[model samples]
Target: MGMIKDAQVSVRDLFRWRQRTVTVDEQGNEHVTFETPSTPPNPIRLLRSISMLGWGAYLIGFFCWTADAFDFHALSIQTVKLSQHFGISRTEISTAVTLTLLLRSVGAAIFGIFSDYFGRKYPLTVNMWILGALQVGSIYAPSWNTFLAIRALFGLGMGGVYGAAAGMALENIPVEARGLMSGIFQQGYSFGYVLAACTNLGVGGATSSWPIMFWVGAAMSFAAGFARLIFPESKQFIEARQNSKGSSTAQFAKNFGKMLKLEWKVCVYSIILMSWFNWFSHTSQDSYTTFMLVGKELNNAAASRASILMKTGAVVGGTFVGYFSQWLGRRRAMIIACFMVCCLIPAWILPETESGLEGGGFMLQFFVQGAWGVVPVYLSEISPPAFRAIFVGLTYQLGNAISAPSTQIINALSDSHTIRNHTGRVVAAYGPVMGIATAIIAVGLALTAAVGPEKKGASFESAAAATTAEAVTDISAAAAPSKAHQSSSVGQATSEEDLAGKKGANGDSHAVLTKTEYA
Candidate 1:
């Protein structure tokens, strides 16, 4: 009931224009105040603030991310065909998905840190190339063991893409436009799903034709990588480099250690939040095509069409909710979307006719991915300025790792359960199982979001500048006492003691600072 009311208020807030003002107090604490606005900022003018180079970086990032999604979904949407081709149960094929998700965290940790220290260009380009090559490699795998090995390798490449792509895409955009752009950027995943479904529809359901989709995925990956090669590094990254002292292995390690020590709570919270979100998406979408085919008794063509429609809804919902989040607030947007999903569950999975199933699938995914659309910017806002790429990628992929078994769990449970099909034959109860799982996940996600921290409208550039200034101040302070002693020995000792106390006080303040106040 409380959730329903919040959802209502969230919807109402979308239509009401409001102005948010940030004020800093004497202690440097920020207070946010909101009021009714007579006129809102022009959306078109807001968009024009992004430079041509910013658009290029965003597009390349979106394309690379889309290509990665295409490669992964190609296998997932073709689960039945792959199962037949490999002469294994659908449950066994799901193991490959599990393995892929399980290894993503490893890649995220490696490539995320590398991207943070060096730049997004080299690490992201290499990851895309690796993904393309692996997509091709999967087509020629002789045995199930070899196939799983390729998929596990694919996860590593896939994991690196999200952090690099998200950082490059969102970092340079104006804060006012980030919500809308984030929505559009996150739709790359949904668009990739749509593309995979279209490809499946074109190639037909023959087990032999699965290789064609892989070929297409490989081509897309390579194309995205090549496109990125022509673009310069992200503007924010370039500015950050200019203002910093220098990057090195030792400096990076020290920074990373300090971040972990000071920001461990945020890190843990993000991982938990991401874990729920990953499960929400995976459990709802991964086996959806299979559910349509077996549970609804739809033909491959109908199932593929329905899958396309479902993801189309995801694209639209993500965009709308993402834009709305700018005014409604990130946490509110997510909470509302999650509660809405709970209401749509019955429609999502219980419909008997193809059109009914289509409508249900579309509406459910609309809200599901709508919540997801806020994720990129929300994660970016809370991330430490210097380690945006690594922090965003590692937390997200670690959550992916935690929820890696969603598909397998769904398949295994559904296989064990039975239901009567239209033909009156007992079949895996995919629909009911998925519906129940989605409801639980949606509720869990909503509750988690309700209690979580938000750093909406945080300024990344300012944070970076503050960090640099603080470092410089520390250096100057350390060197000051050595230059001259203008006091007696007793006075010097007292001044030294006071300085130590001040340092301790500053350390405590730094330790307690929120992600938005990191500097």
Candidate 2:
């Protein structure tokens, strides 16, 4: 019971969002401290800190995530065509998507654990290859069951790629660069959606068969896999593997178990936070188009145009807001975006005319996804080093799994409610339901972010190093007050190094500071 209390207190303290201090020394070199919130580096210095090697890794990871989005949007965009092919209702066809979301947790657990135990490179390579193959198989599926089977398999592969790619991209880069790059990297999802929309507009319009779009996605996945192969293992992963060379198998297991036992509280809290975020995104995005057409009585062309505009807004908001997270702090940026979304709900839902609805959708998604832009970096910062991939990926996918039925839930809730359209036809009041749900979710997002922790520039070296540091601190603290002070100072230095974005020996001096450091 005492251990449990300690764990709870540690988690509460670690995640309680606090400001950090950024200071520049006499040599014009900047240092980051956790005293309080202050000035961040200027745009020019931040830009200068970006290295060619870091950018290369980031670009590769970006495209990989982009391809993941492409494949996902392929199914989302072609729901009507798929229903026609399978001779099923649109709701029945939507089961495939729900199943994919639920099953991604299985993939995240599988690949995330593997990436932590082994390295990010091979697992990610295999993930891309499998994703490509699954898309190809999807093209040849003989029946609805077969199509769903392929997608389920595709979900497993899709589940693993994000964690591995995020680890590679963000972990290998200099800490200072992570904030800006996280925004750019995460926008790969929105960019992929935009690309998929264009492809469907062109290719889906031209071909009677939906398989061609799958074929295109498969090709893109193959290209992403090839690109990953050209780049070697990330510096962070290689260093981690090297550091674990002398440890016996049993010791490794013991260390991992200990870390998990200690950090379980934080893990649970993270899952809750991620669940709200997933609900916020899936609820707002997946059903808005349907609501616009059915409830608002917009023409098909107008609805499509509004959707495109919404996605365009997502792209801009995601990139710009992601970059802003570095300056504003992750939680603050997220709350601000969510608040803007909450405020815009009236404009977004109450509009009866096409132009009003279109403009509202654009602005709504701008803020909705702008908050999302911080997710990758925010999750990365809070994650454990040895299990960075697993912790972030598992929590994220589990949240998604929990929210798998969001669309169905919203649909059911809105079915009985009706509103008089401009033409006086009584349609289901999807707009009201969506507006209320989204508003509630926005509040939840803000509260969760408010209470949660921020490791704005935490280290990403490896989990093993963190465990070792924690052990040392525990021993030293028990020995003498002076030694405990020295140990605390060391932990503080690690944070400074993590936040200051000083170039390490390999030009990517990433290190793992233990969770106890934060506590």
Candidate 3:
């Protein structure tokens, strides 16, 4: 068929398949591309629908972040209470907090892999339940070991939720909203932190009423997870599933292989950025200022309040960054955020007299911390659609893996200075070193971000086209019947556009459909 006549067929095919690729299941042991179809889009309605999904995913991020804030610190305060009850030393009780963060990274990794294989919805829902369960159960644990072990297990749920959520966030939002949504997604951590601090203060004092904190997390997780379960799966993941078949967990491994073959750039990006983003966010949000303020003679209430202010800044920065980055594009927004990091971090160490002084405590806690809204947006924009769930999980967990151990080390190292009260003295002692370390980390990230940054509010298909087009063609070909034809070039053609006339699952015609590699 010629271009014009084929265009009409393509339009109908587009509507029929909705730009989702089609494949064939060959006895569960093998697969082949049945056909490739032209991009299908109800651009107007699709955009709106996707935007709604973005919002829903954003809510997921919000809920997860809030839960983490509640749960992440579960060990910190609970260790104090449980230690008194169980007669364990403060250091020994510390395992509850430490292990939780550490173990959650495993959750993120495993669940992330599951999300890739099973799709994002189920894993996401399950993770929420885990969080809620831990909150409810941890309140009444009989032994210190059991309490700590369960709390650590909760981290796994926390780990799995976001990367999958990140996948959904990208799919649900339109190309235009990618940057903003990314910011919104990433902002969850900071917002969650703020939510935690405020919740702690609101729900009776932690000193007398630490158990209330767990109750609050449980309640929120239940409500949100319940509401969230009704939300739709990421169209991206759904589309991918429909194009392939057979529910065996082994397919998960196969899909990862496809992902590796198709989108290695994204994988590289995930690994590289994961370290910086995860470590810095974890270190700063979970520990630093609280430790410093406590060391400097600040009361728990005052320190908690300071944490609230800082995390609130992060929330605000993220919420605003989401929309703002939509206008600016992901890379530029990230560049701006990177510059902000460079600017905000050095204040951590300056002498009180030398430091800007008046709001230095607040600045370190909130402003510097608040600048974290950059990561989600970047990751969301960069990932491949087919492999999103898996990649997000992998990259995010990879980051967490690096951060989890590092946070523990930071805790161990900083434990010596013991910032019980005075905020000033604490900043004087540890703030500068942390600030420098963070800045160095930021600069290193800035270098890798040299991938010329993505433009905001453009066609996602086009953005991913160059990277994914060939893989799409190959995967489609693999599922095709013997009739599928290729350009007779062994990828020596230098461009995917050269290949033509491929049929996909429903026997649709498309320009990109050549032949599946396995087919």
Say which candidate scores most in TM-score: 1
Order of the predicted models by TM-score, top scorer first? 1, 2, 3
Which is better, 2 or 3, measured by TM-score? Answer: 2
List all candidate RMSDs to the true structure.
Answer: 8.8, 6.5, 10.5
Cα-based lDDT at residue 445, candidate 3: 58
lDDT of 2 by residue, 339-379 (tens): 99999999988888878887887898888889888989888
TM values, all candidates? 0.85, 0.83, 0.70
lDDT of 3 by residue, 61-153 (tens): 566655655666655533344556678655566556566656666787688777766666777777787788888888888777778777777
- Top candidate, metric lDDT: 1
Query: Which is the winner by lDDT between candidate 1 and candidate 3?
Result: 1
Off by over 4 Å in 2: 1-18, 21-33, 36-40, 204-209, 247-251, 297-301, 352-354, 462-519
lDDT of 1 by residue, 1-519 (tens): 433443343344334344222322222233333333333356688789898877888888899989999999989999999999999999999999999999999999999987876788888888899999999999999999999999999999999999999988987788888888999899999999999999999999788999999999999999988887778876666675676664456656666676676556568878999999999999999999999888877999999999999999999999888988887778788999998999999888877888888899899999999999999998887676667888899999999999999999999999999999777888899988999999999999887776555456765564332134333332223223332333422110121122233332224111112112221
Total backbone collisions, model 3? 35
lDDT of 2: 0.72
For model 2, name the residue pairs that clash. 15-452, 15-453, 20-36, 386-463, 461-511
Candidate 3 CA-lDDT value: 0.54
| Superposition error at 467 for model 1 (Å) | 12
